[model samples]
Target: MATPTQVPGWIAVDWGTSNLRVWALDDRANILAETQSPLGMNAIAGDEKLSFEGVLISLIDAWLPSDARGVPVVICGMAGARQGWLEAPYCDVPARPSDLAQGAVQPNVRDPRILVSILPGLCQRDDADVMRGEETQLVGFMDAHPGFAGWVCLPGTHSKWARVSNGEISGFRTYMSGEVFALLSQNSILRHSVKEGWDDGAFADAVRAAKVQPASFLHSLFTVRARALVARDGAAVAPGGAVLSGTVIGAEIADVLGLLQPGEEIALIGAGKLASLYQAALGVHGHKATPMDGTAITLAGLTQAYHTLKTASERI
Candidate 1:
């Protein structure tokens, strides 16, 4: 075991639905250690009899340094929900990193010396939706682009398109495109309807179809099966078949793109492949796209939350 001298200055955590990410940082904000585990909300939700605090303690004990037992820790994401350890209430839209930090929920745990603060998620009355983890990504984006003013597209299970001005998240909308795609490709009849591989030409063709005839999105989706049946003997599309699948989704994105003002910049946040696909779709609609890794932004947001908490404490 390491001595007290080796203990980290602080701990940052991004606990979400399927994974737990922890980072041990020094006073200067450099990460000295990092760990991840499968103790996500899904695992905890599966065992409702166990209090969330108990599950968290077990997970933290397995990962945190013994010497760093009493270090301050800050957390972001679902860990702050009503179903989680403590209820960190939601902050309304046009929120800032400081707003979330100020709304941190401090849970009463066995380790009294360990300071733990959970950041709140973002909600907008206008949008009639809520975003828990994505707000952290927006915080990190603001950190990277200090004076940026434009729209950001965070494509994921629930894709979010946010409008940011100065450093605050002004407005946003969530689309179920990613989740819809997942369901159609994996669970719905469409699974067996398309070929296994992607073809750029076919994808571009579908994109074009969707863009021109967006009202046909639902109609065009089902036709993929008909196309495979007639053209490929009921087999999925050949090598370029995946592109056809993308076209249907790309068409939906094209419809949304019409709402944006001309010259508005768009930033895509997610894994590289998904971001690239969205970039391609956005390009087809004549919008410039920038991509950032979702994980990096989450970590950066957690770090920003920690700093915000530390500053608030100092002020108090």
Candidate 2:
């Protein structure tokens, strides 16, 4: 067995649909190096024997110190699944810190000394949807806000509104707002109609329109192009751009925020663009929003899972 000093360092990875992000951290959790690859789960589709071990080894080989080839590594996100290298089963709703830590680790076929653990996704019965990677964000949130208690909004392609009480994820819901927006803006007829640049003024105006008439999201989305062409004299050529941005985001906030009572704390997770948009919308509805770095949260999540596993191994 490699001595503690000889173990090199821990590796944290957030392997998702579109990209594979890897971080090399010292024992202190400070990042020493990082790398990314386009070998996302989505890109590997159609291949019957997609070898995650091969992808990981290739990435790690470039970064790993020659002497620390045996260092243990931990991974989160889609890497743990029936489609992934090994299935890390879903932890049920209202998952506790202990519950989150109780996941299985599978060794890579290419390297046995390279211990790997995959974080389990979340499943809730309140909705038909499921979340694979957002749970790590939640773990990261809990780690940052040790005693933080309240609800958090993780905005993304599939936005998740999670309720946490006393450091445990008590419940949550998922909205297909991002997916819907993508489909409408890129795949649907609205693709040809909208302008390319972002107009804050236009976006805000569209938000106001959605707020006043919630039911018009779908109907009003098409009007973006029409409004730009006929009403604004092509000034709003990016009609779909502003309209889709406002309608989908505004409508989602209106629908999800309804679950909260007066003065409920809301935390926003993800990149600045998406989180800032949600922050603006929440502000409009009289809610104060706190922003957390999505990447930081993901790293913290990996740390949490690692610590949990360490603790469990000690107990066993």
Candidate 3:
């Protein structure tokens, strides 16, 4: 059996639907140890109530020292969903992202070695939009860019466009553009049509086409299919992935353009491929986008929340 790494003063967790990660942090906020599990909410051992605590206990049981008393664990993500460990209700927008700590919840568990606090998600009532883990990222981003005010685009499976003003999120919208691309490329016929490796020219042209003729966006998608099937050695085979991504993202960007101010720049918070793709796409509009690392933002946000909780606890 593998021995568990030594525990630290506190734990930071980002538990989502598919997985959960925990970082043991010293009092000074430096990471001492980190681990994760595939036993997320979706793959728990039992019902919502039983599974979360059970899986959580299983994951961190070895980390707790025998004499430890209520080791603080600050967590955020879908683990606090209605059906997860405990529902840390949604906090309405136009509120400081750092204030998420105020909405944290403590799940009732028999274990004395752990005290878990789950941060609340954010909601925009008017838009019928809600976000869980992303709010923490926003807080981290805001922490990095104090007094930042503008459109913040977080591209992923479900891309988010949030308006951050004075450290608070005024409003936001979620797009299924990434999911659309995935479905088209992986599940739909386009998967067979488009190969990897980007063609910048093709991507740029598709972006322009979709942005200008948003209504014909579906027609452009169909073109990829037709080109691939009709011509074996053709335009569609090489640049299918890029074109599909460009077309969907372009339409999304064009649609969301109204949310942006004239010549206003965007804060693109993401990492790796998604970040580069968004930067390239946003560049097409002549709009400047500043890139922020997703992992760094998560750490910053969690640290902020951990401190806020620490402060509150100290006050009491």
Please write out the lDDT profile of model 3 over residues 140-219, one tens digit for every residue. Answer: 88888886778889898888988988778888899999888889988987887676677987787788888789789878
Predicted structure 1: lDDT? 0.75
Candidate 2 residue spans exceeding 4 A from truth:
1-7, 48-50, 62-70, 228-240
| lDDT-better candidate, 1 vs 2 | 2
Which candidate number has the best lDDT? 3
lDDT by residue for model 1 over 1-316, one digit each (tens)? 1222346688778888887887777887777767777777777877877655665555455345544455678888888877777878999987887898888988877764367888899998964988887888899888888877778889877888888877888888888887777777778777786547777666767777787887887777777766766785565454434654566557667766776676566788877777887877777667777678888888788888888888878888
lDDT score for candidate 2 against the true structure: 0.76
Give candidate 1 misplaced runs (Cα > 4 Å): 1-5, 48-51, 59-70, 230-244
lDDT at 261, model 1: 72
Residue-pair clashes per candidate, as listed? 4, 3, 0
Write down the lDDT of every candidate, Cα atoms only: 0.75, 0.76, 0.82
Which 10-residue window in model 3 sums to the lowest lDDT?
A: 1-10
Q: Which model, 1 or 2, shows the larger TM-score? A: 1
Candidate 3 lDDT? 0.82
Give the true-structure RMSD of model 1. 3.0
- TM-scores for candidates 1 onward, in order: 0.88, 0.87, 0.90
